[model samples]
Target: MTFVSFLRKNLQKEIFQVKGDKLIHVLPLAKIDKREAANYLCVSVSSTNDVYITLLNVMEEKTVLKCETRHNWLLKDLKLIDGIDQLQDNAEFCLHFDTKIFNLEAYSTASKYAFLRCLRKMSSKYLQYELQWIHFDQDFVGKSHSLLVPDDAVLSMQICLEAFTCACLCSCF
Candidate 1:
């Protein structure tokens, strides 16, 4: 399997290892607003409490995984690659960039889908940036390793690039 897939599977397993505290917020549902989507969207984050968010740039060999004692992921810039339903009944989604990959999970399938929808809507509306931030990593420092691309991945990437180019050309008026 590709490194990204392997990391994704392992991370999914690790995320399930934790069953967070059962503390539900008591608030009324408000009208969905694009401006408020970024902050209002919430999900049950997984991984151990000790694991802090880490942003790594593999190609540049640069990282910004540490800043303060804790991080507010809602404030950072991120992109959701694969939406929810990658795994049935297991609220999980994948995020990636040119180098890094982030796996996030919610409590249930409903919450997972809801979070994914809100995130996609918000991102498309406001944060049109590429997926360059890494928000979930256990070993912050060592997580900056270079991405491994095998022969299959290279071929798949070529195929995808060709398809994308064709689509772009066809769409041009």
Candidate 2:
């Protein structure tokens, strides 16, 4: 996976591994906004404690297992990725958006065209990016490593670039 996607994958993996008390709370995620892609819109978020709990109803219903977290999921899965500093303070006017949460399946495969096209539709709606390039390696930082064509990694890179850009815009605006 590209470094960005690698970070995202690791971030996604970390979401499930979040220890007690450190868990990122669940919140309502909007699929779209009326704002332009270059800006991060400020919208109130509602807390959802039973967000994943609803999966109980779909399990016995059908093959709801397409892409999922390490723990398995249905309809949607939630992930939180962020730095500790962004949320170090909590008070009036505090923002819970220092970290980002991804709600996609744990696994997926799409080509560049299909991925970018898909992104244009439901994408974060929170971010946008002009993809540069992507390269993958077992250890991206290793000098002796060889880069491979990023199949899934490219899709994730697209997501992260867009999400990071969204976060920056939100904070600046």
Among these predictions, the greatest TM-score belongs to: 1
Where is model 1 poorest over a 10-residue stretch in terms of lDDT? 21-30
Summing lDDT over every window of 10 consecutive residues in candidate 2, give the lowest-scoring window.
51-60
> For all the candidates, what are their Cα RMSDs to the real structure?
17.9, 18.9
Colliding residue pairs in candidate 1: none
Candidate 2 residue lDDT tens string, 1-173? 55334433433344334421112212112223334111111111113321121111011126322223222221122222111121222111111222433232111222222322222222233233222212212122112122573434554565588789999999998
Off by over 4 Å in 2: 1-147
| Superposition-based RMSD of candidate 2 using all C-alpha atoms, in angstroms | 18.9
| Model 2 residue pairs with clashes | 68-106
Error of 1 at 111 (Å): 0.9
lDDT for model 1 comes to 0.35
Q: Which candidate number maximizes lDDT?
A: 1
